[model samples]
Target: MRIALSSYRSKPHSGGQGIYVRHLSRELAALGHDVTVFSGPPYPELDDARLVAGRATDRATGPASRQTSSAKRAGATASIEPMSIEPTSIERASVEPPNPGRLRLEKLASLDLYNDDDPFRHPDPRELRDRIDVVEYAGMLSGSFPEPRTFGMRLAREMRSRSREFDVLHDNQTLAPGLLDIARGGLPVVTTIHHPISADRRLEIEAATNPWRKYTKWRWYSFVPMQARVARASSRIITVSETSRDDIVREFGVDPERISIIPVGVDVETFTPDAGVAKNAPGIAVETSAPGVDVETFWPDGSARHRVPGRLTTITSANVPLKGLSVLIDALAFLPQDAWRELVVVGTPNRAVETQLEALGLSPRVRFVSGISDDDLAGLLASAAVHVVPSLYEGFSLPAVEAMACGTPVVATRVGALPQLVHGTDGETSAVTGSAGRVPAAHGGSAGPRAHATGEADTSADADGSDAGILVEPGDAHALAGGIVSLLESEETRTRFGRVGRRRAVTTYSWRAVAEATAAVYTEEIARC
Candidate 1:
């Protein structure tokens, strides 16, 4: 199959879009298909993603030069070779995108207004040569996110000359108005919305205290209406979790039949357990540098990777409010000093979070690591006493899946996909079936009933609680703190959850499986068209 994949901004190191694009394209190519990715700034990094478009591009320098924010690209240092295709190398109509079993990347030039180099930059009069550029500039001036809508317009224009060039078009959450135009051009279309943007707008607006901030959030998410319209009209829709699926049905009013659930996967090879580094005890290190153990085992030939005792960690692609970084900090404050020692966040620094840490006197105990490799992250998870997903919502968390693959037990909120991914069951029943309280550490412990918000009950738990990891109510710092404290206080329970989680991640969320399912969707949509 010849698949044309599209995305707006893809930060290779941190964000979900880049990770999804890279891994999925690689896996699809491995399955004997030709995949050409049409992406905006900060293009994805792929082994064979060197696809050249027959047409000219706006930015010839590619990912590095197009980057807008230094913070967004804090750890995004890997560089791709300059695009070697010259102007008029090939006409738009005459194209050959590698063989059936390869992947290529094509860069789509964008106005790039929100670049950190000069945020909300004023476009030179000469730079606004096209209508798309003008629209992008005007949207930025209005404090509204215009990338999705503008990127779609650009993509629609690019596809005008060759609509039948590919078997199907797979859009990566860029639900701009132009997608309807693409589908009308006789191309099979599939849009994968991780979650409803409406939820983001609501959460950000609610999180804001200032009325001006609330108004700005409302203005920023104004594009969501167009997204909902496009989502409703698309031939097929894909989402990561049932939570997101439900939200899309309710929030966007898209028919449930139009949506298909295809969860994301982790690289099992990169995220495996390290037996050399001993797992830290609840609040202390177990001694990795003692006796015959080599120090190199603890520290690979990489950058600084200090293994903190009693390490509690979480990952966020961006330090946004919906991710619940503040909630995590609040939960940490609820614990005693000895209950949990240090926190390690895997993302660029945020000033708001830093200020919160300073106010709570957790400045010294918390550390943020960025730009690390998958191997480094796997090792870190293996060394952690507990991994946490304290987000207010999630649409299938890759970080949680990766941690589980690394055999690290997780403590996550009972919202979105966290419950299903941590619960060792499918999307529906896993979260509700588990007991709320701690799993007994004693061998052959009796089970309890299903738990409620303000009350407790008994259910049949996996004596080992291996059926799932610990889950707490969303936005409740007290419940989150109790869940973490319970895991830290018992090594037996943590070990069981970690073992079960690892098994679930390895067996359930295979990249091959995900690619196969996605390809099946492509085949069905193509046939329908």
Candidate 2:
């Protein structure tokens, strides 16, 4: 199989794009398929044995120069490497404040400053857009967000000119306007909706206060309509979790039959319990470190509970509001002092969540860990007794999953497919079925007569109370904190839940299984076409 995966920005460290491309391609390559990833800047770091493409260099000497020179050299020898195709690179104007830490050019006339942030500038957007049989372009870029639509337009243009080269086209959530044409063009198309943006949109809107703020929120989510359309047009759709699948059905009106659930898997090898087993817990220092402890374990959210001496605690890998950093901080406020703690949020810092935390008087307890690695993260997760995934919503909740994989119990919101992913230690399930509160009567109205006949009344009453960890109403900080506190204090229950979560993660969530399931879908879609 010759597969082309299209991603606008392939940040290896953050989000699901890197996870999807890296694991899926590795699995496919293992199965003897030729996978060529057609990606934008910060390309995937594929194994050298499987691929040959651009290597990152300084801005003065990037892949484009190397490729052009190599092409000329190859022309001289009349030989070219297979899959040695040059990727598209675009230069645009960067408006970001220059890094003061690094040497800067003082107003050198701003003449043709080569900024690569713009996706359309890359010739490969047009080239691969035309050439690849299947382009899995990422939808969630900074703003221009043209992965689905542009790929469709480019695919349609190429199909018209070349008379069909691909059996099917797969999209990764961009759901651009161009996809409608690709669908109308009679090509088999499938799009993966991790979950609908509607949930995030609604959360962001509710989280906003002023009119201009709400308007800005709307502008950021402007691409959602495109996704809704592409989702409707595609022949089949894939989602990461059953939670998300049901969300799509309710939110996007996509039929459940058309949607398939292929759960995302973590790299167990990279995200295992032992990866950081040797490291001493971060911020905790003893006159003599414990034997077999190598890296520091951080518990920013729950660090106040553990008086691990000398380790600098950090949390909030991405300090965005969606990540529930504010809620974690809120939970911290409920705790007494002398638990001295700090956190390091992983991604670009956002002051809004931090400022809110500060306003609540919990700022001293939290610090953001700006840049870190998966292995370092594994070390942190391994040493910590509790890892919090306070996100209001998540497509797959990678951090929580990775935390569980590392034998650390996770305290995640029972929202957005997370409950389905993480099981309770007591093997108990929450009473709440979906986010729509308690289930109503079968015909309509309250569960009166129907409840009696089916015993739903007793069931509903039983499920009402929090079970395992906690099941709070979505976005309710008080309830979320209560759940975190309950779980954090009960060492016995936490250990039980951690054991169950680890077992579930190891048995059910493996990239090998995910790859097989995904490949089955690819085969089925191609067969249909």
Candidate 3:
């Protein structure tokens, strides 16, 4: 079977979209399917598969290609073309590379010349007047997010012309207007929403201080309109977790029956534990270049586990607000420290969040890293005793799971599908809640942290249950600090949680299992069609 996967931006390090495209395409190809990814700029590198670059597309390409051809005709044998050898034979040369900048333009036109029967190709208008309105462009002009809409429109154009070449169109979260048109055009379409963008929008709205800021955040998320549209049109909707599935149903008003909970799997081949490190350390490492900061710090003892490190060497990624860096910072205040620890966050720092960190008097204890290598990250996680994931909500906490996979204990919030992913035997979980409606905080190091429910019966936070790791109130810095201290102070609990978390992650969240489940959904949908 041949499949075409679509997404707007797919830079490997950008985030989930890149990760999803890379792994899913690999898994699908490994299963003996021919997968061709039709993406825009920063196209994915589908290693080991026949990943044909789609039509070289952009506004300037058409004119650029035409200009290149005209230039070539005027001076045939005088000058050599920079982009490619001017069509070798005079008869074969109709279009020439206009200029280096316009090579993409000619390439778009050259697509059909090289591959005639490749039906999974988008249309390249023959005449300039034949072009149609790009709703995506219009949406962008209106201050609504536009990539998804544009990508969807392009996808629909391809599906209508080349629907016979592919078995189905698998959309990677670009819920665009044309997706429904493609589906209604009789091609089977399936979509995977890693989670909803609406969740981000909601968080941004809450974070906004004024109406103008709120309106701007809302405008930036204008893509939600397209997502909602494509999500409803998809024949089968796949998401990373039950938490996400429920969120989509509630947020998008989609029927629960239409959604399938297929968790995204990690590539264990590239994510195994390193055996060199003995004990992991957490501390702060300040930057000399950063404004208003002096020396780096390290805290070897868990006394101020979340503090800045003077001699400490560690790396963390904290671009995600849900990752709970703020709570971690708050926890730092509870520890006894005088700049003895260093923590290097391997990503962009949220200056706003950083201001709060500085106000906590921890500005000297943190280091921010950008463009870190995978080996460095893996080595860092491998050496660390603990990797903290202070998220308020998570569909499937990858950082926590990845840390465990690297043999490190994770201190994560008891929210979303985290408990299901982290806890085993369900004994510790059920004991806390009992039959009654009240869930008591498990208390200090000896008592274990409490499992306060988040007003949900199924979640680990259920005021009525017990679970692995500490269950704390969402966005509560104090409770978050207490939970981190409970685990940090006890090596036994950390080891126990690490082992159990690794076991669960491997047994349930492996990509092989996820792909098999996802394939089954594709099969079922095709059968229905």
Each prediction's TM-score against the native?
Answer: 0.82, 0.68, 0.71
Superposed on all Cα atoms, model 2 deviates from the true structure by an RMSD in Å of 12.7
Better of 1 and 2 by TM-score: 1
**Candidate number achieving the greatest TM-score relative to the actual structure:** 1
Please provide, for model 2 over 1-529, each residue's C-alpha lDDT reduced to its tens digit, 9 standing for 90 to 100.
Answer: 5444445434454556645665565555455554444444444333321221121211211122111110010011112222232332322111111221111111101111122355334333433432231232332323334344454455455445433544555556656666566667666666777889888788887888899888878776776777776676567887876567777888777877777777677666545656554444454321111223233335433333342332222244444567676666666666435432333344444656646665776554454443344555555556555566667777777667676676665655656656555532123322222221111111111122212221111112124222223334444556554555555556676666656666666766676666566666766777777
Which of 2 and 3 is ahead in lDDT? Answer: 3
Show the lowest summed lDDT stretch of 10 residues, model 3.
66-75
Q: What digit string (tens of lDDT, one per residue) describes model 3 on residues 253-367?
A: 7787887777666544333464223224453343432477765323244223232212222223335455566666676686557423545554556677678776876766666
After superposition, the stretches of candidate 1 with alpha carbons farther than 4 Å from their true spots are 49-99, 275-308, 426-450, 454-461
Model 1 poorest ten-residue lDDT run: 437-446
> In model 3, which runs have C-alpha deviations exceeding 4 angstroms?
49-138, 275-323, 338-340, 424-450, 453-468
Residue 304 in candidate 2, Cα distance off native in Å: 18
lDDT of 1 by residue, 373-429 (tens): 454567667777889888888877888888887778888776777756765553322
